[model samples]
Every structure is written in structure tokens, then in C-alpha cells.
Target: MRRVVIIGAGLTGLSAAYHLRQLRVEADVLERETRPGGACRTTSRNGFHFDLTGHLLHLARPESQKLLREIGIRNALRSHRRRAGIALAGCVTPYPIQINTYRLPREIRRDCLLGFIEAHLGKADSDTQPRNFLEWVLSRFGDGFARHFFIPYNRKLYCTDPAELTTEWVGRYVPRPDLADVVDGSLGLYRKRVGYNATFLYPREGGIQLLADAIAATFPPVRLSCAVRSLHLGAKEAVLESGEVVPWDALVMTAPLSHLAAMTADLPAAGRAAAARLRAVAVVNLNLGVRGPAPRREHWLYVPEERFPFYRVGIPSNHGAVAPPGCHTLSVEVSLPAGAATASGLRERCLEGLMELGLLRDAADVVTVDEVHLDPAYVIFDAARPEAVSTLRDAYRAAGVALAGRWAEWKYSTMEDALWDGATVARRLAG
Candidate 1:
């Protein structure tokens, strides 16, 4: 029998193990955390269940739905049309502000609409191939929309200048409405949902961890709280934090690519250099349990203004019964460069911003506060990412290491993509 070891035990790792079991193969899943879900884990405080962050499932593929049904979680998830918006200039407008400019201030609406018309009429002269994300936005949505929403919102979320990012990771995530749609939006006539997350599914009660836990139950028990200290690639062995070495013929890695690069012992100098070039941002997630009903009816809101410490805020209770009967939950997200020190008093700043926006009636309404810092929360898709990822992948592949999941591939992705990645890698290993 060929020995196989899967690391991370995230959704991707669990899926890989589950699929491997179906193929009559067995693999040991090692998880450094006490629980299975990586970023998908949820916590309960004062009867309020809070996820690490918002993790809604957008399942576009049939296989994903089939897997959920097979795992008995299909009935647990309920579908919902997204009630999301962008808050700016003291007014709240539906999300994809590109198509819902009608609710924005008159001046901003005029700028966005006129900019779209001008760009549409001059599409022939604009660059067909954009050099960066900034160029792409300008060419597609024009300067007005770029200046108002895309540029500022992305800047706050990615924690970098939009011009510094590449367009490689923008597929399906950003909606590019036609001229007619834009005009309709300017007139408040557009009602159709746009973007990949226009509609999604969430667990009715267990928070997002229910999906992870369900998949994990289909396979052998995962070794929890066992951290991987380093990898001896040539030796096909992984050294645990406790000094135990586990050997395997095939290794599936679903953790962050940066971690993989740091741990591998036999990586070449060029591989190390490539790893050094990879960049990502961290997220300081603040989950709050409020004493009353949710302040906003929308599931979440995007904050483009720089004055707000948080780029986004979510009312988790609006989507599920995660809070007590009379209580609600609030999630605030602040992004920083990976390994960057979180600014002092960030929590207080977030509360102030929320109250300023009227999302929070009073600071005294709070019950419990929990903060989770996730380093490498989002991969910065810069110009050098392609070459860097390719270099690291080639170096690791030579040693029989298979990478799976969003952090492993070092790209933007959803929970569904993670499941597919796991199954695909598992089948390859089984063969």
C-alpha cells in the first residue's frame, strides 16, 4: 500500500480524504488546529455563534451539490438572495454599485453614468489588454466609477494600490454590466442580481463549520492539534512539532503556499526567492454579540471610505439564527499587510465607525467581543504572482507534493473551489 499524508485538514484536505476513501485508498489527515475547519471554523460566545469571517457557499457546480447531499448537509443549508450594499457619502446603495448607482448621491450618480457612456462610446481606442487592475477598471467602467467605488473599495480591502494588482484574479468576481444595464441602474430600473455571490447558501444553525464537519465525518478521523514543523522533501518525511517524523509516498498540502515554501528543506535558492516575492494581506476580524436585534436588514455592507477602520461589516444574524432570540451578531473586517502589526485601538475605531454610520445605536449594546487575526487572509494578485507560483509549484511537484485549496494554489477562490481542488487531487493520488 502506498502511504499518503494530507496536511491542513481544511475543507480541501477533508474532501481529498473522503474521495480517497471512496476509491478504496486510505490517507492520514494532519491538522495543526484543534478543530478541522481552517478558516471555516465557527465559535460560540454567550449563545452567539460567530464564524472566523463570513463564509457563504456559492455552489455553481453540480458535483459540489452532490457532495453536500451525499454528506447529508444538503438539507441543512438554506438558499438566500444576497442583500448586500455599499455605504458611502452618507447613503446606502445596493452592491455592485456599478449597477445600482440610482441610490447614490446625485453628483456621484451623474459621474458614474456619464463615465460609463463616455467609456462605452470610446471602447475602440482603449487598451484591449489591460496592464493592471486599475487599467481594467478604467477601460471597462470608466474613470467616474473607478474613482468612486472600485478604486477606493479595493484599495481598502486589498490594502494596496489598485494599480499594483494584476487582472488575473478578477474573473466572475467583478460584474461588468452592459451600457443598457448601467443606464437602467442609473434610473433605478435594474433589479437583477449580478456577480458570483448574488445568491448563496448558509447553514440554518451550525454556522459554516457544519459543512466542514460533515465532510470530515465521511472519512477516517483526522489527527488534530498536530503541527507540521518542517518537510524533508527528498526523504518523503514530515517532521512534527513534537519531533516525530512521518514518512509518506505522496503528500497533499492544503495549507498556505508561503508556509510550504518556508518548511520544505530541499528547496532551491530560486524557489526560495520566488516564495519571498509572494505577498498577501491579513484580516483582523472582530465579531460582536449585540444585546438587541440587528441594526441593518442587509446581510453585509461594503465601506469604501478610508475614514472607516473596517472595509466591511456584516450582520450575521440577518442570514442565520446564530444569535439568541433577542440578540444579534456583528462582524467587522480590517485588512493589513501580512505580518504587519495591527494598529492599536482598532476595535474601538471600528465601533466608532459603525456608530457614525448608524449601524450601531450605542456602544453599550454590545455583549461579547472576539477578535481573530488571520494572516494571509487574501492573496495579493500582483504582476509577479504567476511566475512566482509557477516556480514554487514546479519545485514542490518534483518532490511528489501536491498542492490543493485556495491558500495552497495562492489565488482567489470560494469554498466550492476548495472542495473541487481536494477531490481532484485525491483522485490523482489514488490512480
Candidate 2:
């Protein structure tokens, strides 16, 4: 029997272990944290439940749906037609601002509509082939939409210049409205939802940790608080903090790729250098349990203007039973470069921004405030990302390590992708 060891009992690691068991292959799961569910875990504070950040499930694959059924969480997860919006130019507009710009201020609306027309009418053969994210946004959505929403929102979210980013991560995440749709949107006639996440599934109660917990229940108990001090790839062994040597025929790493590189004791110089080239932004997730009901009916709002400290704000209470009977939960997300120092009074600034945007009434109404800082929250897909990720992954695989999930694979992805990656890696190792 081949020995298998998985690191970081996140959704990906837990799913990998579960599938491995179904395949009749046993595996050891190690988690640095005392609890499972990485970012999927939820914390309860003063009767309000909060996840690390916004984690909604958008299941498009039959396999993912089937897995949910098998794990007995299919019914526990409820579907929701996304009620999301964008806050800009002193007015809140429906999301995908490309097609829903009618509600925006007159001048902003005019700019967006005219820019779309110009981009569409003056488009050339070269315009269709965007070299970077900036070019892609300019070509596809035009200058007005790009300037108003895409450029500022993404820049604030990714914490990088749009031109420095690549288009590889923008496949279906960014919706492309047609000329008719754009025109209808400008006229406030476009009502069709047009994105991969237009409709999503979230846990009815107990937060997203339910999915992770259910999957873990079907597998062997994961070793909690068992941190891997370093990886001896040459000897095919992992040295735990307690000095326990866990040898494995295959190792599934669901931790950050940068962490993997930093922890490996004998990785080649080129592999380490390639890993170092990978860049990402961190998120400061401020979870608040306010006194009153949510001010907005929309589940979340995208904040694009530089005046706002957060790129996005979400009302988690709108989607699930995460809040108390009378109170609502707010999930505010601010992005910064990975390892950057979090500024003092940032939380105060976020509250002020929320109030300024009319999302909150008074800071004194706040009950509980929780903050979570996630490093490498979003992987930066730059021009060199493809070659760098490929080189590192190939090198690690050759050394008996398989990277899984968003952080390990080093890309932008959702919860469903995590499950898919886990099961895929498990099947490959089982074979």
C-alpha cells in the first residue's frame, strides 16, 4: 500500500481525503490550525456568526453537485439569485454596471454608454486581442465602463495596476454584455442576469464550515494542530513541529504555494526563485454584527471609488441565518499587498466609509467587531504567472508533492473549484 499524506485540512484537503477513502486508499491529514476549514471556518461572536470572508458556492459541475449530495449537505445549501450591486458616483446601481448603468448619474451614464459605442464601432482586429487586463477591459467593455467600474474596482480589489495583471483569470468571472444588452442596460431595460455567479448556493445555517465538516466526517480524523515544520522532499518525508517524521509515497499540499516553497528544505534554487516570483494581495476582512436590520436589501455592494477603504461590502445576514434575530452582519473587505502593514485606525475608516455610503446608520449601534487578515487572499495573475506557476508545479510534482486548491495552485477560484481540485488530485493519486 502506498502511503499518502495531505497538508492543511482545508476544503481541498478534506475533500481529497474523503475521495481517497472512497477509492479505498488511506491518507493522513495534517492541519496547522486546531480547527478545520481554513478560510471556510465560521466564528460566533455575541450571537453573530462570521466567516473569514464571503464564501458562496457557485456549483456548475454535476460532479460538485453529486459530491454535495453524497456528503449530505445538498439540502442544507440553499440557492439564491444574486442580489448584488455597485456603489459609485453617489448612487447604487445593479451589478455588471456595463448593462445596468441607467441608474447611475446622468454624466457617468453618458460616459459609459458612449464609451461602449465607441469601443464597439471603432474596434479593429488588433483590439480583439487584448495583451493585458487593462486592454481587455478597454476593448471588451470600453473606456467608460472600464474607468467607472472595472478599472477602479479591480485595482482596489487586486491592489495592482490593471496593466500589470493578466487576462487568464478573467474568463467567466467578468461578464461581457452584448451591444443590445449594453444598450438595454443604459435604458434600464436589461433585467437578465449575465454571469457565472448570477445564482449561487450558500449554507442555510451554520456558515460554510458545514460543508467542510460533513466531508471530514466521512474520512479519518485529521491531525489537528499538527504543523509541518519543514518538508524534506529529497527524502520524501515531512517533519512535523513535534519532530514526527511522516513519510509518504505522495503528498498533497493545500497550503499556499509560497509557504510550500519556503518550508521545503531541499528545493532547487530555480524552483524557489520561481515560487518567489508569484505575487498576491492580502485581504483585511472586517466582520461586524450591527444593532439593526441591514440597511440595504442587496446582498453585497462593490465599492470602486478611492474614497472608500473597502473594495466590497456584504450583508451576510441577507443570504443566511448568520446573524441574531434583530441584528445583521456586515462583511467588509479591504485589499493590500501581501505582507503589507495594516494601517492604524483602518477599522474606524471602514466604518466611516460604510456610513458615508449609507450602509450604516451609526457606529454606536455596532455590537461586535471581528477582524481577520488573510495573506495571499488573491493570487496576482501577472504576465509571468503562467510560466512561473508551471515551473514550480512541475518541479514540486517531480518531488512527490501535488498542489491543490486556490492557494496551492496559485490562482483566483471559488469554493466549488476547491472541491473539484481536491477530488481530481485524489483520483490521480489513487490511480
Candidate 3:
């Protein structure tokens, strides 16, 4: 590639630029925002620090861990034992809910074990593949667990019918307990660790954005506040909002692939419509700086109750001493529907939730409530998502356009996945 242009200076875009420099390929990175880190951004409010959303570095992959060390934040990255839990039916149950059912109420525990036994006996097993996410959950966990956790939690997160979504993306991120694990859990004897993120990593200070900031510092200074307004793929050029025309040998776009069809003048009508149908959940992050001890010592909680407007809560203070002396912090994630209602009322909703959940003692203890909303936080996998994503990628690739990151790839992924995406694309483009 003679002249490579990377759009969006998020981790992926910055990673691409970093690797390109190693290959002696100088690249220009364009970011519309004033700062570099996209979704991995962190803000300091008073004495509390809050990320864009819940972001923890899982150094599960060797390559990902190596990248961290290379970025010089490895020492700063603190190892955290995952103490995540779920708030269901007014009870705090250990996560995976399968291995930890022993802590649940007797009747609920019985139902969960029996469901697992039935599913394990092959009576509930179906030879046909699961048609949707609900089916997959039911087949592996049965109705008891589904009704209590999976169904409600997913509904809150996706804001869509789980049955309408395909099971393609449910590739074992959630633990599927067998008979032994289920029996032990129900009998109050299970102690096995479950889930892929059993142990994770986070920065000791500066919140999660330290990783993003460290990575960004390695790349050449980015062209900030430069949004791509239009693209002429055939001519290998981009028109920025500032009326500056950027010419390139190859375009590496890290923005949402579906959202790009409108910008590129050469995309076909069918591709554009397919792109339009792609759906994702917008995330509203509410961070509270409190004047007392944290309600719990756990890193975070998966709140599945309907009354609670938030799906997940991250205790940033637990990760490190993010809050000032005599204060604690909590970060909450709330999903919004297609057309979001007015956000003016969301603060009260979140405050009420924290109090109801027994986290906040009184309204007087509240310090600061920082609200940050991220558009298209999660890629909603409907029947159309696969086709839409494929169509978008095929069209872009055919035009010699390179894509990078979770948004551009339109896949359910983690931070490591995003980094890998950028590195892979940069290598391919440079090759």
C-alpha cells in the first residue's frame, strides 16, 4: 500500500497504525472526536473515573497479553479475580448461576437442578440445531434457569425478542453446566469456577482507558476532529467534514460497516438497504460517585431484574482506588431502544435502582452521577445480521476497501478481538 488511510482512531485504528509503522508503512489516522480512544474512553468527574462502558482487559490470549506489555502498561495492569454476580428476584446469586445455584432459595435451586437433570438425560435434547438463542439456552439449561436469568437478562440487554435471534453468536461465551455441576450446585456443594472470564485484568489506575491511551501514544499523532463525510471508493479518496479531501492507496475504516454504505457512492441499492437493517443496542452508562463504602466488594454485577433500568454494573472503584478518599464509585450500563426516550429521567431511574438494590444507603450519599451514552454498543444478531454483515464486507472488499475493529466487522467481540482485527488487517494490507 502506497498511502494507507485509517478511519476512527480507536484501539483498532491505532493498533493498525502502530503495526503499519513497524512495517515502515506510514499511515494517516482520522478521528472525528477530539480525543483518540473511541469506545474505550475514560473521563474523570470530580474524584471518580468512569469508562465509556464496562471495559476490562482479559489477557486470555497470549498475543493480546504481548500487545499489552508492548504498550508499556503491563505493570500498570492489575490482575483481578472475577467476583461477578447476578441480581434476580431480589437475590444476589453467584454468576454462571449454574455452579452457584447452591446459594439460591431452596425451591429455585431445586427447579434449576431438575432442569439440568432433564436436559442432561437427553429427554430435552433435540437432534436439530437450535433455531435461535432461546432454544439454545433451553436445550442446555432448561426452562427453570431460562425463565429466571437468561431470558430476562438478554431481553434487557438486546431490547429484542430472543427467539427471533439466531444462536450463531452464542458460541459458548456462557457456561453450559452438565449434570455433575448442576447437582452439586443445587445441593449446596458446588465450587467449580465457570465462564471464560473467570480471571481478568484491569488497569490499577486511570480506569480502563489507560490501555487505550498507552496504545494511542505509540502511534503517530492522529488527525482528530476529522470525520469522513463521503467516500469515492473507485477513486480511493475520502471527503472529510472539514472539506479536506484525503487521497489514499487503501482505506481502512473502523467505523460501523453498516453505517458506511451511505457514505461510499459506489455501493449498490440492495447493499445499502441490508446495511440499514443492521441493528445494535445503544448503551447509556451512568457513573455515580458516592460518599461511603461500596455496596459490594465484587467487581461488577449482572442485574437481570426488570425494575432495574440497567443490565450490568461495574464497580470501577473495586478495580482500583479510582475514587478519592472517603468515597466509592459505581458504573451502570442501560440499554436503549431504537428511538431512545428522553434521558432526563434516566438519572432518577438509576438512583432509584441503586437504592432498591441496597447499594446506596440514601440519596444524600450521592456525589456525582455521570451519564455517558454509546450508540450501537452491541450488535443485535437477528436473521438479517449475517446477510447484512456479509453483504457489507463483500462490497467493501470488492472495492479494495479494508475494514477493521468490532464495529467495522459487525461481530460480537471483546477488546482483544478488536486489537487482533486491526493487527490482522494491517498485516494483510501491508503484505
Supply every candidate's count of residue pairs whose N, Cα or C atoms clash at under 3 angstroms.
Answer: 0, 0, 0
For residues 177-199, what per-residue lDDT tens digits would candidate 1 score against the true structure? 99999999999999899888989
TM-score for each of the candidates: 0.99, 0.98, 0.96
* Reference-based lDDT, residue 323, model 1: 93
lDDT of 3 by residue, 186-218 (tens): 766777676778888887877877877787888
For residue 40, model 2's alpha carbon misses the true position, in angstroms, by: 0.9
Better of 1 and 2 by lDDT: 1
lDDT by residue (tens digit), candidate 2, 129-185: 788999988888789999988889899999999999989988888888789999999
lDDT of each: 0.93, 0.91, 0.83
Those runs of model 2 whose alpha carbons end farther than 4 Å from true positions after fitting are 125-128
Error of 2 at 332 (Å): 0.4
The candidate 1 region of ten consecutive residues with least summed lDDT is 121-130
- Cα TM-score of candidate 2: 0.98
Higher-TM-score candidate of 1 and 2: 1
Task: Give the best candidate by lDDT.
Answer: 1
